[model samples]
Target chain A: MKKLINLQPSKPVRVLLGLLPFIILLLLYIGASDARLADNPNDKLLPSLNSFVEAIDRMAFTADKRSGGYLFWQDSYSSLKRLFTGVGISAALALSLGVLMGAIPFFRAKLSPLVTAISLIPPMAILPILFIIFGLGEFSKVVLIVIGIAPFITRDVLQRVQEIPSEQIIKAQTLGANTWQIILRVILPQIMPRLLAAVRLSLGAAWLFLIAAEAIAATDGLGYRIFLVRRYLSMDVILPYVAWITLLAFIIDYLIRLASAKLYPWFHSQEN
Target chain B: MSYLNIQNLWKEYGDQIVLEQINNKVEKGDFVTIVGASGCGKTTFLKMLLGTETPSRGQILLDGQPIASEPNEERGIVFQRYSVFPHMTVLENVMLSRELESSPILGRLFGKQKKQAAEDAKQMIELVGLSHALNKYPHELSGGMQQRLALAQSLIKKPRILLLDEPFGALDPGIRTDMHQLVLKLWKEHQLTIFMITHDIKEGFFLGTRLWVFDKDRFDPQAPNAYGAKITYDLPVGDIDKETYQQIDQSLTPSEPEIAEAS
Candidate 1:
């Protein structure tokens, strides 16, 4: 036999490469199942298949009026919208607090004990406290996210501010930059990439927290829906919802990475 | 009176003495370069002058007045690294000092108020041959270009004296030569007093109107005020076009036996 050539797919040719494995698996699966289908003694399979197709077709056609309840994927959109609101608020509050703490050493020092205490206890531990304070509403969810995310953001920005090259600060002083100029101009730019990285990391944390928050006290989120499926042992619904969550998280993470790469190309160079 | 004088200068880090009983005088518009081996406190001395660091003993008198701590705007300094702000464009870096001088109040208002400052920045950018990249960020430039941007930032301040700490040491040989020539041209054009430190002996000889050979052993790390690793000798490098004078001075310069005793 002639020697076989093993070809590695490159980035540009990845689509074609990806299809190869799928096609092979599909053919093998169909070939193996073909005998089983013919061997089946049930003409009753027609009724079940008809019911499955009918349900799918009805949902596909009437998806608009039902508020997309039948389409699990459409329900995920509402969940996503709610998650976005939670995340946006969390990020803004955390970023503001982070910048404030990072900029003022006195404030950071004064708040050190309290911040340490709060951050040491995971937000999940204080579910009862959040329930008491904000109730089992959106307020509780937002509080859960902010508490989970703020300390990490503050520490990240603080470290970045501290790690800013002293030479740059000294140089700015020599150039006659006042304290404010040094902070706003020289120090700010240096810390921005790290701060952004912290925000991206916080977003992922917030996403996880949102699910946890919904699980603690909520009726309508992806996590809630997943919980509902588990109670009924409906793995079909659970499986699709799980896949949807995974895909959504992947897209969010990818978008964040893309933003980071665009904003901070120097980070890639630093890795090497 | 000397334009600036370093009399009985001393510096120490904890128990270690880096500079001790050093005396030197510089005239207005003179280009002075100090060269030494590594860890010889060349940068330490420059920092002391810039008031970034304090001398353990002794005083520096500028224009016959003793300098107290750091002056607001009398001296400009450039460093080996491109200390230009990566966020700001080249023009902004050069105009910073002028902005400080002209708009003491405008800065409070966050107003960009220096028409003359902008003009001066443009001229300095052109002087550095960076007219085309005036609006570019420091990170956009090559290392040499960034250093030139840094140089422009320093010179535009128009301080009575310029202090450079091995500003061109980071450049390649060809770019170093170019920078050396550029420094000469800028010195001549501006008639600015320049004091610089460098490890390159030839570079010292090329630009320095007067060069100081800092003796190595004199820097006593244990002493409270060490004079930079025991500068074993001092040589008054003669003026340019005086190679024969340098030869004569070299012979007159203390021999090893005398240097050891003095050190």
Candidate 2:
């Protein structure tokens, strides 16, 4: 008897398998929206596919009269700038501080408890304080993302550094690495990929914090626009904004994953 | 002063005596292997010699100077596993010492020093038969290749002493034999002082110019730290053939120490 399917699918089939769920989701949403619009000509809850396409076209293609800029591109740029700035700061801080904490006993003893406590605190809880101290501007928003993600990244980097086999450090010392040298040359390279993984994990929280900050106080941003249209029950605008955010997050995540694999081919194989 | 001298060496952790009254001398170019049962403290002793641990009661002098309290470039070590830096390619692993030395800030040395480092690493890799694997990471290499990488990484530093803790314990019999020959050749060619610990008696006897048997002379559960593992036998193995190893084995007994005064 001939088999209906091979045990493992080929590349094209594998890609189709991955895309199937998203296609089905689009179909289901479209069907629901079609039914709702059929019931009510002005229904905004589940907007018609035409409404979403029209909204996207207006936001993406049309220029705002006041600023003469595409609102979508403006929102995207502001959001990404804040997001990358915050994540980049957090990652850099984590790499330097975490290596010291993990490698030096004095630093570990002094900082580990503080890191644990900070990681435990809900970053959202400090939003009010951040606004009070840093002001309700770009500074506050970026700091919110940094506050929300830095401690976790630090802890992750610390753990990865600590997890490096003591043998490697000892070997490096025997090869003439001083304290700083061991931290920089031996421990840092080992923890770098893990640092990338930490940054990727923290991206979700970074977005959450960025959006929360923008929603509360901002003239322009993806989150501000979503919140701005919500009062008018403009699901057309809000849904697309949410989808755009998701698409952006997915693209960044995928890019980071690809970069990690390229930069650290050994890390993936070492796990197996 | 001897090439390496240990006087009244003792190690204790919270009244748990690990090594007690360990005294020995090793000359330059000596290939000494210490053999013992599990939990016999040979590894601990090796760590002390590597300066990872400070002795409770005595000092180790190398070339008439006290060994540093922390590991330094004077000593190199290869453990049973986890010795190779998995993050580095073969060339980078071997070049790390010179690279770190030349460029302390960047973790890389550039231009002429970089070229020199590469040349030195390439030579060492070729010596270890890993020239074909210069670009390969540690995980991509086989067990023997990884161990060879570790050796190359260590030897590039040109350390005064090389320590091995069951380095061949994980290899197959054939590979282990080849590694033995390789170590011997490296020792002879480099004139290295080698101190290896092993569980296999045959291996210990076969590879060592001198051998130390570590065990407790007296046992007391009630007062455990009162006595601990010591060098029970230190014998000069003039030859490492089957007949010689068998003769030494036959003459061994429970109560009597065999050639305790070799050093």
Candidate 3:
């Protein structure tokens, strides 16, 4: 029975399986929302229907700006780039500090309590201080995020490093490994799984902070656009941006997990 | 002078004494096994030999010189479950020890000597009957196989003394016997001096050319009287037969709490 469950889906089977959800959801939404359809159905649907088909046609052919859909695409692309860069910078800073704190015992002991204290202070509490310090710029937003995300990363990784079996370190030492060798070969491999998990968790926190940071402190990001739409009560625009963020987060998390499984096949087998 | 000698060795933990007046000698290529019930300080004896722990009373001399304060390349140790690096392949683990001992800065950067050490590691793996598992991680291998890899890594450095702390306690009886034979074969071929600690009487009797038993006061017959006391046995192993081993097992009464036996 376990063996049967482990069998990989064929290409066509996987494709069909992937499409099955969208198909089901599409049918459900159409069926469920159809009852509330407006009496002037043509008036409500005709322009959007025509615009959707035209947008698809334009996308299929060229970069022609027919009906200002080009503006939406451009804004989304720039927003995506900004979001990913923001996430990457914060994650990188967090991971570096995390690994550094995790590997050094004295640093871990001395710094961890301060980190815990800082992490408990609400992220929302930091905006005014950040604005006062960095004066309402990108620096304030990025710095706010780095401060918010790095402690969780450090705490998770420090705990993980401590949890690695002491036997592994002793084994390497008996084999004549130096401190650096032990870290690179033995400690790093053991912590990679924990590190990956920490990153996956922090990615969500970082995203939350990013939107909050952008919405309050700056402009020209998805968070700002969402906040702007909310002001006008533009639920459609707001909902779509939320959907995009959710989809992107899901994709990034999935990709990282896939990479982890590939790099550490031993973990996946144990997971079963 | 003996190849390895301890001079009036004494070990104590604060007010409690662990080992008192331990004086022993091991010749070149000798297989010495220490056997005792739990908490007999057999492990402490090995730790002193490895220089991992200190004896408060005396000094250890290897090759007629005092052993240093830290562990060195001359003593290779095999732990119970953690002898091999779990993440690295068998080949990588074996080669890494050699690289640590020999590689220079430029050689390490270029990985030149490491490459050569890898080939040598492959040869050692073949010697240990694990060539097929050269690329497998420790977790992917069986317990017996992992122990075999541990042996390979220990031997790869060609250390003068091989210290084992009940390395086969986790293996089944049959696999344990196989590992014993494999270890003896490698030891004989390399003329390696072995100091192993085990609680298994059969294993102690079977492997050691000379067996020393630790009779701690806790496990000894008379607790209050035998407190801070010990008895050592030097059982000669020469042309021993199965019946003789059985006789040795049957003749002795172990120290039970209420029943005190004289040494």
A130: Cα error in model 2, Å: 1.5
Please give, for residues A1-272, the per-residue lDDT of candidate 2 as tens digits. 45767477889999999999999999999899889888998998998888899999989999988889999999999989999999999999988889999999899999999989988889889999998998888999988888889999998888888888898889888888888788777788788889999999889899999999999988888988899889999998899899889999999999998998988899987777
CA lDDT, candidate 3, residue B104: 30
Q: Which ranges of candidate 3 are over 4 A from the true structure?
A: A1-104, B102-112, B217-231, B239-255, B258-263
What fraction of native interface contacts is shared by candidate 1? 0.33
lDDT of 3 by residue, B119-189 (tens): 88898999889998878878889999999999999898888889998999999889998999999999899
Which candidate leads in DockQ? 2
Mind giving the per-residue lDDT tens digits that candidate 1 earns over A44-118?
A: 222233334554455334564636555555557656876777666655665555555666678678875676777
Q: Candidate 1 chain A — worst ten consecutive residues by lDDT sum?
A: A41-50
Question: Candidate 3 residues A1-272, lDDT tens each?
Answer: 45986999899999999999999976775554454355444332222333344544444344646554443465466555655665667556655566666777777778777888988988778789888988977677676666777677767877777766665666666667666766767676777776777778888777787788778855567787778757756544555567777988999899999999999876666567
iRMS of each prediction: 3.6, 1.1, 2.9
lDDT of 3 at B40: 56
Model 3 pairs in collision:
none
B1-263: candidate 1 lDDT, tens digit per residue: 89998888888777666666788888898898887655557778888888878888889999988764653457777778847766567887788776655545443223355666688789999999999997786767887898888888888777788888888878899898889888999999999899888877777777868776665443333432433543333445554456643553453344455466668
Q: Which ten residues in a row have the lowest lDDT in candidate 2 chain A?
A: A1-10
Misplaced by over 4 Å in model 2 are A1-14, B239-263
